[model samples]
Target: MSLPKPVMRGLLAKRLRFHLPIAFGLAITTALVFKYTVTEPRKKAYADFYKQYDAVKEFNAMREAGVFESVRPSGE
Candidate 1:
């Protein structure tokens, strides 16, 4: 048996008010969380690793170019 039109409409309206905000809030919260949690950390880590790698490369170059050879200790 089908619900009467007014009853169906009222039921639908009630359900929408209850569920819609929850769904929309969850979607927005998820998006913000993903951006801050996943994207920001990954970007920071990449930048940090890049900087560290560059520093290491520069250090190696300096060592090879005799800039810090005196500090290298003769035993190695």
Candidate 2:
């Protein structure tokens, strides 16, 4: 025996309302997992690179190249 039309529609609506949010939540959780897993190592590598970089050496090299004159102010 077939369900009445209104009953069928009600079942469909309830099923969609229940499952849609679950599906959406799972999709968001999965995307977050993949994003953090893929990017964490790259972020750590960048942090290490910056930690080792010598800003003073880079500044002196630029000065030697005449990119800047004396470190003293031009107003001096």
Candidate 3:
């Protein structure tokens, strides 16, 4: 037996309604997984670098070596 046009339309609408959210949720989950996988290593590397790096020590060493003295402004 053939379904009426209205019945087919209703069925199509119901199917779309049921599957749309699942598709949306899967897309979001996949994007988040890829994002974290790509960024986690970079973030960890930055954290590790910062943990061992000290700006003050580097600045003081540069100053003691007269690196900044030549570049210093006369007014300063």
lDDT of each: 0.83, 0.82, 0.83
Q: What TM-score would each prediction reach against the true structure?
A: 0.51, 0.49, 0.49
Query: Cα RMSD (Å) per model?
Result: 8.9, 5.3, 5.4
Q: Whose TM-score is greatest here?
A: 1
lDDT of 3 at 30: 95
Could you give candidate 2's per-residue lDDT for residues 1-76 as a string of tens digits?
9966665647878999999999999999999998799888789899999998999888877766668755743345
Lowest summed lDDT across 10 adjacent residues in model 3 is found at 67-76
- Candidate 1 ranges beyond 4 A from true positions: 1-6, 54-76
lDDT of 1 at 38: 100
Clashing pairs in 1: none
Better of 2 and 3 by lDDT: 3
Q: Work out how many backbone clashes candidate 1 has.
A: 0
State the lDDT of candidate 1 residue by residue for 9-56, as single tens digits: 478889999999999999999999999999999999999888758776
Give a tens-digit lDDT track for model 3, residues 1-76: 9966665647878999999999999999999998899888889999999999999888877776668856553345
Worst 10 residues of 2 by lDDT: 67-76
Candidate 3: clashing residue pairs, number: 0
